[model samples]
Target: MSFGLVNVPVRLFSATENHDVQFRQVHEKDGGRIKYQRICSIDGEEVPYSDIAKGYEAADGQMVILSDEDLGSLPTRTTKEISIEKFVPSEQIDPLLFDKSYYLEPDKTGLKPYVLLRDALEKADRMALVTVSVRSRMTLAVLRVREGVIVLQTLLWADEVRKPEFESLSEETHATQKELAMASSLVDSLSGDYEPDEFEDDYAEAVAKLVETKIEGGDITETPEAKGEESEVVDLLAALQRSVDKAKAAKAGGASSSGASEAAQAAGGSDSGSDGGSDGGASDESDAGKARKTAARKAPAKKSATKKAATKTAAKTTAKTAAKKSTTKKAATKKAS
Candidate 1:
């Protein structure tokens, strides 16, 4: 990495790992793996991987083939250093702009300069906005410290993020202070420090369990889909109040705490058919305990039923108001004619 006259030799390593479960296509009858062949479209013949070359098509239906030598001759192909442009407050960069992250390790000779830069950035509480070339592409990036190590994070171009263009979002809406207070109460009830280690991928675990059950020749019972309790329209204020009540109940070890969770979910959505409920936490508890918890949670379903009725009443009132306005306008126009 280079900053003006100072150069720091460093190595880059990817900072994240994906833990998604992978699957392969196979023949169901014979249990054979499916395979694919690359065939040339012009001649309809199978082509070897060695014969493939990168090609770019233009708007005029012309193909431009690029070879290894042509790519090597490009200015950014052999870039081996990060060029720091300037320092800016870390908050200045939007989290949305962040792409891939890499850990930067200093070379033996660069230790002093690396520490100098890292310490400076830490003390200033800023990030070094820089340009870097990776995989023959020059892109914007930032250098920041993470646990005493200087980390490099790539940024997406400004045009990459799409602008939201929704009519509903364009309209202005206001909330009453009572509603705001209830919402704040709900937020406070659910507030907790974020600890990533406390969470696990429950879906992945379920898939693995299914596979294990099949291997052991055990009967696999399909899980029933959750009923669409969240599909009904709800009164926002009432839902929020119920959610706060539920949170309090849960915190106080009240028997109706489970009902509180459902009320909270209802509060999150409106009559516009928005989804409200979120998936529950990781499946780390024992099956018996899980069953007990699930049984206890049934009270929330009854609580949400009340919101459904409230939503229907609101919808009826809106429909009646629109009908009355239309009727009055038609009568006035007829009388004038």
Candidate 2:
């Protein structure tokens, strides 16, 4: 890696590894592995991997065949060294732009300089914005310290990250200070230092266990599906308050109650109208159903009140019109006499 006037000879190693279970595609009848061949569309002949060349299809339906020689002559050839451009505050870079990461180890000759750079970065809380050519493509990358080792992480180009165009996100929304306080309390209740060791990849472990079971002549049974939470458009303030209370209760005595109970308490009288429905006898009505029922009850009352007021106003108008007509008729009769 190039660092100003000093060059640090370093080796790059992948920072992460996948631990997913692997599967093979095979013929059901004979258990033979399924294989594919590369065939040319024009000639209908199978082509060997050695004869394959990269091809790009144009907008006008023309194929552009690129040979090894043509590709090699391109400007974006791999550079052996990582060139540091500048250093910037690490917080300024968005984590969303981070792509792939590699651990950089220094050669014996460059050990001192490597330690110096790493210590400087950690001390200053900055990342070195660098450019590195990898896989025949020049890409922008950053060098930062991770667990005392310098890590080089590639970044996506500005255009690669898309701008979200969600309608709900564009719409104006507001929340009361009370709701915010409750949400903040909930967050505080659950806040802790993130330790990666505290979590495990359950899916991977389950897959490995399943394969082991099959290998041991065990019968494979379907895993029980977890109960899904009912979709709800809950009152934000009520939900936050419930969450905060639950967290506090859990912290107090390690005793906890079901979320359903909390949701029911939060809903209060919202479920009253639900009894009139066809599923009124159903005790397992969702919180969303309760909210809907509450809205239904309120809407009819508002409509009925409006209608009654309108009817009374109409009756008064009719009586006033009749009285005015009688007075006008009497005045005309007296004038004529």
Candidate 3:
């Protein structure tokens, strides 16, 4: 809080926290919750919290016990003050060095200086380098403006940053220009502007979704379960080829299914039309059969009328012959008288 004659009374706030899903150990046989107790290794006994003291073991196997009173009496670099040494461009700090962050809220008395410092840092686009002791350990930190508030970000020490000592990378490796160009082209094709909001904690989301699903479905696991899996070695190039082929096959399968569905629907329409035509043809044949039956029923009546007319004509001719013979016999009788 004391930086170059500018003092600001501020309260510290943790900037980040873990949101990972957590699990606890449990007894497998009886489904009981398991508890851990701190036991003294040398004495082979359980120790109470009041009897436990912070101890540091030296290489010579000597344990140095430090009580809370001893730690309180120790001298520290800061007298409850955040000391800002200098200001530097923000880019000079490596992201790897960043450890933790805290937001500083100004007290009622120190509001003006906090605003002044916040405005100055924002205008200059720089981060204030500072040193603060935390948890009995002093570390490097930076002060910057975030959301109109001052944020203190702790940094790791140079010795804390481990050196890369991988044997695989220790040997020199070379690539052809063509390979480099192809890799660059791949990167270019896939390059996009970063948006932090678009990314999410997939594992946490999946866990939440699973819990929600189980709650809604009224499903709960009673005991721990064991699962099995399988793995195999495959050529990298062949795997890529298979992936591409699989994607293409899936796309083609989807298209083919759509086409088949359409064809089925069309065939159904055609079948309906064909069934209607068959019904119509059956109805026409029924009408034609009725007409033929009517014509056959009238033929017998017409034949009976023709036979009756022939009989009448024969009777008329016989009567005319009898009349002519009677007239000839009367004339002959007159001639003999």
> Tens digit of lDDT per residue, candidate 2, span 95-173?
9999999999999999999999999999999999999999979999999999999999999999999998999988788
Q: Let me know the TM-score candidate 1 reaches against the reference structure.
A: 0.58
lDDT of each: 0.70, 0.71, 0.69
What is the C-alpha lDDT profile of model 3 across 182-245, one tens digit per residue? Answer: 9999999999999989999999999999989997897754664322222123355568899999
lDDT of 1 by residue, 279-304 (tens): 11111112223333333444345545
Query: How do the predictions measure up, each by TM-score?
Result: 0.58, 0.60, 0.58
Give each prediction's root-mean-square deviation over alpha carbons: 34.8, 33.6, 30.9
Q: Extract clashing residue pairs from model 2.
A: none
> How much is the lDDT of residue 53 in candidate 3?
92
Which ranking of candidates, highest TM-score first?
Answer: 2, 3, 1
For model 1, which pairs clash? 246-260
Report how far residue 200 has shifted in candidate 2, in Å: 0.4
Whose TM-score is greatest here? 2
User: Candidate 1 or 2, higher TM-score?
Assistant: 2
Worst 10 residues of 2 by lDDT: 252-261
Report how far residue 179 has shifted in candidate 2, in Å. Answer: 3.4
